[model samples]
Target: MSRKIERLINLTIALLATKRYLTKSEIFRSVEGYEGSAETKERMFERDKDDLRSLGIEIEVGSFDPLFNDEAGYRIKQEKYQLDLGAITSTEVSLLSLAAQAWQGASFDEAAQKALLKLNSMGVPSDSLSLPTAAHKIDDGGGDLPLITKAIAEQQLITFTYVDSQLDRHQRKVVPVGLSSRSGFWYLSGVDQDVQEIRTFRIDRIEGEITSTKGPKDFEPPQGFDPARVFDGSSSQSFAIIDVRKGKGTSLRALATSAQSLGEWDQLKLPIYNLNTLASLVLWHGIDVYVQEPLELRGLIVAQLETLVSNHG
Candidate 1:
């Protein structure tokens, strides 16, 4: 790892290690030997804080007294912290198991196994620990499981071939960042080299070797790249607020009835990243949801509706 990233990780580990929050000055004093002067130490502190944020660490800093005006300190929220694996969901247990079973020879296997054991010790029902049908049936085609898992384990890059729903094939190289499960599918979030953008691809669609490649020494993800947004099917490419309504709260016809109906009700604002996905969902679950912002999404939804109607008619 680069010196900056290494120091940042050390700083995060140090912050997470302590119970009481520490002020920036305290942190700088603690890390005085990290090769910097007082001014450089302050800059390093800011950089380390930004790095932590980039890695999705929610560190809060604030002062208790306005009159006294003591230096602000930082602390991780204990409620969201996970020091044990056993408390995680059974589905998560199964996914971990699949990962373990698929790539046992990887460098992180022992650690992962220990984590799995910790989870198994937890109260997840025995039956629920079994891998789901989708996961169990996924053939690896005798591919290099160790290499793939190592890539994920070491936070490296991996390239693979995937077959889309249309039966078309494409080769994609991605810097694997995270993995997640939603709606009964496993998805890998990564930065696509070809597109030069972050994207989520269904693991089941993956058709070839998960080749391990050296990660870019300094590549970093852009801010606000939430992997879940891709599967949620509603995210904005840029910062843009849009409104939404739940199906249960209001009828679609009622919502569209009059200016009063639309104005008087509360709305759910969202940043749509994939408008096409949102359009498809609206078509699939008609009258159950409403898109209230970014008129473009509304237009896309209308177009999708017309396409569906024409095809069906």
Candidate 2:
């Protein structure tokens, strides 16, 4: 592109931004970095004006100009410029502010805060509200979310320090595959280089910067592979299920959605398992959960409950 053309585009954009019409002389004064004779500049402006018109700018020649007597200039109509705020209601703003505060301590995008602020600036009435400043408190100490996000987007392998629920820390080199959220917890699904197996690690448990290894993220998830099934503590060797009811049913539904083979539970005959996953499901679901199948599982639940009662006893 010619320098003249570039400058013309920039000047046109600037003139349109002021929400007012500008004469040729005014536009020339406002536009910088253009050095040419008056006749040459005039010729260039005329060509640029035609170019702008060709580009659908609607550059009016004889537009209203208070400074000149019946002078012509260019103006972008107000209707042409739009920043749709979605007709925000006061109640919606309050609700959005509350929702943003709730994400204060969690992993979130910076754009989220900016978008919230922009919404508030547009008559959202968010100035009186104080959201949790905990969001800003998070530094680049734990996880480099931007790097991880880029790696995930580029389908690149990432190496990072991952700590399990058991508090066991290890350096994990994994092929970054996918990201998901469950029960308000963020999870990163990837293939462990050490184990050659796909696994899901909680994002919060990751306590170090993730480095992109530039390794090919070309591995495919195994056929019939299911992430939710991995969390269920069910493997090719053994598997189990339990009837989860009430909110537990919702959990099971989420699991089923993520991993289709978990199937459904018989609410009347709730299935239970001796597996850690079934136990976790029970514990997570709390006292209202019941063991439906497998007498062994029932015994395991009873044993755990007895231990709990004895601990409190």
Candidate 3:
């Protein structure tokens, strides 16, 4: 990390750790990388404020007194600064188990661990990813993971109630084919008997119990069916070059194959293990992270953001 990035992380940690707004004098005395003459420190502080805002981190500026004009103080509101992905759906242990089967020790292992550390520092529990490989074993509120895994292993037909992205609830019958995992979510891709087509279902979104409709080896997976490519047609892996705003997209920075300083934005060549997974990660950084290559990935990011705005409009 550069001195500036270290300063920014330290600054963020300090501001987020405090309950009260810290004044400029207090910040200079306490926060690292704020050295130099008073005038120099003032300039650095102003630039830091701009950089933080560019990362979509809101710094609250207020005064100590309402009646008398006092020196302004700064603090960040957790509700505003933190990405409220909303308790984020938990990772399914079964998905991790499935991933462990096909994980194959890829480029994301190191970056994944670093991202876990960053998340843990932000007060997110470390249990989800206590260790690199152990990270894949944690539960994601998918209590039916074991059942799903068992159904797959037995080659049995299973029935379960699932809620789709649109919140439509329906009972699904699937002839277990193969399993796929990405970004902590487990997906069961198989032949949906009712729809008479292959569909991928997120394990966590599955509601109620998964019942085995028949004995083991009840059905065979469709000929030449590829679970990873089912429904969404997601590639196994992709490489992307991203334009990350300075002092932002810290997670991406950690995962980049190469990062070059581009003044305002850092150009990062990153290996994308899963495009949807990478898309979600990039979206988390908001405008601070921009995809400069792989137009498909950029389109996905924009489409997801637009859907969020449209649905929540």
In angstroms, how far off is 46's CA in candidate 2?
36
Model 2 residue 221 CA deviation (Å) reads 7.4
Residue 53 in candidate 1 has what lDDT? 83
Better of 1 and 3 by lDDT: 3
- Report the alpha-carbon TM-score of model 2 versus the true structure: 0.43
lDDT of 3 by residue, 1-313 (tens): 4999989888888888888888999999999999899999999899998999987799999877778788888989888876455653335333333454333354344444554444545554323444455444444454565566777777778988999756899898897777777777778887888776777888878888888867434455668878766533243366899999998888788777788898998899888667888898988998798888899998998899899999999
Clashing pairs in model 3?
90-140, 91-139, 91-140, 92-140
What number of clashing residue pairs does each candidate have, in the order they appear? 4, 5, 4
Candidate 1 vs 3: which has more TM-score: 1
TM-score of each: 0.42, 0.43, 0.38
Taking all chains together, the TM-score of candidate 3 against the true structure is: 0.38
Tell me, by lDDT, which candidate is best: 3
Candidate 3 deviates by what RMSD? 27.3
Best-to-worst lDDT order:
3, 1, 2
> Can you write out model 2's per-residue Cα lDDT over 81-122, one digit (the tens) per residue?
334656777777776666655545435535558657866777
Off by over 4 Å in 2: 1-143, 216-274, 283-288
Index of the highest-TM-score prediction: 2
